[model samples]
Target: MATCEADCDAAPVPLKIMPKDYVYSLLEDPQRILSPPTAVGETLGIRGSFEYFHYGCDGHQDAGWGCGYRTLQSAISWIIRRRDSSSVSVKDQHVPSIREIQQILVNIGDKGAGFEGSRDWIGTLEEFYVIDVLYQLPCRILHVKELGSAEALAQIRSYFEEYQGFIAVGGISDTASKAIIGYHCSAETGRVYLLIVDPHFASVPSCRQQLIDEGYVRWVPVDEFPAGTYNLCLILQP
Candidate 1:
């Protein structure tokens, strides 16, 4: 609903695949991990799987710190499209451009820490609440601290069961802040995966070209995600 004259140009460095050792380290507690789901959409009565969608890599002028914004764009666009569409056609749905998303962030007071865009970010949970209130969209934010991994997974599963859409997530990686879109889960296996649309890049144009050619959404196993606090934002009922 908002617009920006300037475009997001920040492109992330080429992504590095998560090493198996690192993933193993993160899952020191094997009890927290689950197997992958064997059931497909129809078999599970989920209607269908929601395919990955990117709101472009240069979200918020490709600012290095706008991962939160980019992540929000992906989740919000998916929810809106699903709410408005009569059929499952992710490709033909309307999605806000990068500039429009930036404008919405600004309108919701998400400008960075200093100088209006100085790499600061609105806290992930706070931003979810802002988006929920401003857009009149239903959102549920769950803190991992309050609900251990098992409980958290249960809550997230319930959300997807009801909404059948991806949610926004934030966590730590390489000791730095990161934001991503959580799109899939398997109750049978107790596993979840997310689309990591990293926002920090060395060359905006080149990185975006690479994403377009190879796809932007890189699925990462949640159990292997870095050690840090995580927030799950469930965009409810579209």
Candidate 2:
């Protein structure tokens, strides 16, 4: 595992283009609603990833419009660490910087008309651009329209069982999005909480540590998930 550093030292890895066989799977309320695992201090996350804040830049200042890139970068960094850690030392890992993220947006081809790369908007499809264009991994997009709390938790647990991690967007508000890199289940209350890397925060080098100190990843009730309508991006390796 790469040790946490002042710079979130996750070295960049060669972008692996996902094979054509790897495509996004859309599911609307999968019928499997099995009981979750014993909620005894269970938790999951990208081993060496850190929290990131999206702000400071002109167009990226708004939490609503900027969360798309922030959330996508969060997932990309996690995947990079998961893929590149084995070859580098704790100090040598390449963490994706804000500049890299903007470049990625530019490289994805179309940013839409009147697109100044700033104040532009993107949704689940744009999220796919980062996943499909920026990395080599098979991903599944779960279009959760009205999924029950129990069913959603079961599906999330099932995905973690099969993939490294997943990204969830929408459902919180009109435009709130975050990366679901980890989860925790409490045995005492039998409540399940997802450990997420929320992208809404003031831009600062201490953002990651601030999140950790604030217990941002604390277990949050799965049933109370904010998004009434959400998309779960199931990221997997080919």
Against the hidden reference, what TM-scores do the models get? 0.54, 0.65
lDDT value for candidate 1? 0.44
Deviation in angstroms for 15 in model 2? Answer: 12
Quantify how close model 1 is to the true structure by its C-alpha RMSD in Å: 13.0
Q: Give Cα-based local distance difference scores for all models.
A: 0.44, 0.52
Tens digits of per-residue lDDT for model 2, 82-136: 6655554423534343344444545554453335436665565566655655554
- Tell me, by TM-score, which candidate is best: 2
In terms of lDDT, the best-performing candidate is 2
- Ten-residue region with minimum lDDT total, candidate 1: 22-31
TM-score of 1: 0.54
